[model samples]
Target: MKKYLHTGILIVILLLSGFLLWRHSVQTRVSHEVVRVADVGAIAWVPFQVGLEKGFFADEGLSISIVSVQTGDESLKALLSNSVDISLAGIIPYSFVALDHPEIQVLALNTFAKDNQIIARKDSGVSRPEDLIGKKIGYSKTTASDIGVEFFLKNHGITKGQVTLIPMKPFAMPVALATGEIDAYSSWEPNIINGKKLLDTRAILFNDVLSTYTWHGSLMANKTYIESHHSSVLAFLRAWKKSAQFTKDNPTEAIAIASAYTKIPAEALKQIWSRYDFVANPSPEEVVSILRTDLLWANLHRANPLATIPDPVTLLANINESKI
Candidate 1:
């Protein structure tokens, strides 16, 4: 009886030990969820850049692979074609495709601010807003800069016909301005800063022109992806929230990450760092309002416009304010 009792005790202890080991393994297992992201290499995408560099996503049990593109429109295209799981897109491009592509959805707003500006060559006879008339101004069509340039011109009482609007890529705008290919160009940072460097004292920047129009940079994904990978999506947003706080707490480090990722000089990023408000979740109402306004702008500008503008109620469905 003593021998049998001792054997039973030993077996029970062994079983308990094995169960604990299995539970530990289960608790500490690393998730293999890989999220591919497409982003435009710009200062506005600093939160994602910082998060990627700092391994915030890793801490949340996710692996993030990022692809760089030149413009937000390109990033959106990547998202739509299933080339990427998530994309950082501007409100302007999102508005253009929202109705057509019901699968695309806005996960969160990353940054909202007025970052666009008009950079002109002082020698081109553009001393004031009125002087932009009859001058060849380069701008990226179908992006926020296009509408922003229009708004700026309208505010200054200059019609679109008043100035020769030259369509050019953002990266080419600086060189175009430097070589006198275009008298002035309306664009956002890095390009704006580079244009200034090329022209030196001849560069004239109108910073306050786009103040009334707020540009929104958002994280977008396909509705199907969000539905299937709900937990992973939540994890991404949580990592993004952590990164936003990290940026706020350590602006210097965040600027360094942005500089490295964008190849923009740290000094240039620092100059415009305060212009952005990094928020993982922007108000849904505000987003809908902006989309509605941008849709109207797109209808007038896009070659193939939507038959009818999506109502606010319909547009709101595109936004998913998932709390992290």
Candidate 2:
């Protein structure tokens, strides 16, 4: 009789263990089975991080998993390779896509004309686009910065032959310019701010140089992923919009959050943050303008401007003002 009771107890224990394992499996599946996202480590993605930290994505019944990429170009590669579900890089890749593919649709434009200026050495005798010729021009990746420099120089009548373009990262731009390793590197802040102290020249209106330029650091998803999870895409966007509103409402706290992501000091970020005003659905005209320039610039740079550019109207989202 005692042996019979022992066997019965062992069977009950096994059944209970099975029940607990089932519950744990269900919870784990529910926790992360939504959307997978990726972001380049830049200030452009501050709002997305803020939303995740504040439970904004969770509130939308969505789960966004992010992986850090070294640069926007790498992020695009990840999205294309299916390594990441989505990309938070700018529309620069869209330009190459437009010429051929634009598989990644630009869902929303978060910011534009954010202190993306070109500075010069105090005594470099370089003040305008005209002054850039015969000088070594520094640009990184032949990516977004190269596009900016191309337009800035062309509008000033400086051709490719007039200047030398060297590839350098954004942070490295300040040192390259200050050390005079290159005559003028297309500088973007916080490098621009640092460049001001290192190099000695005043900026010559790099912002809106192509007034039609739309440097949108937008949300993008692959066609396959979006097809399978349409609701997930909408939910992520809803969460992102809420974070944008939070940024507008709490400008100070927003800076602290952005400061954490960028690793620039909070005090320094406060000064930089004031220059940019982030938003969603930056007009269609803005998208067209930037695409036109990026494509033409890429053509000149020997990069393949094919396999991604799709129709702008189909890609951009027109959110209702009243809906938000």
Clashes of each: 0, 12
- CA-lDDT, candidates in order: 0.81, 0.67
TM-scores for candidates 1 onward, in order = 0.88, 0.74
Per-residue lDDT of model 1, residues 85-176, tens digit only = 99887888787777577568777767885688889999998898899889999988878778778878888899888899998889999899
Model 1 regions lying over 4 Å from their true place: 1-31, 209-213, 312-323
| Deviation from native of the Cα of residue 144 in model 1, angstroms | 0.9
Q: List where candidate 2 sits over 4 angstroms from the true fold.
A: 1-30, 123-130, 194-214, 283-309, 316-324
Error of 1 at 7 (Å): 14
Poorest lDDT segment (10 consecutive residues) of candidate 1: 312-321
Query: Candidate 1, residue 315: CA error in Å?
Result: 4.6
User: Which TM-score value belongs to model 1?
Assistant: 0.88
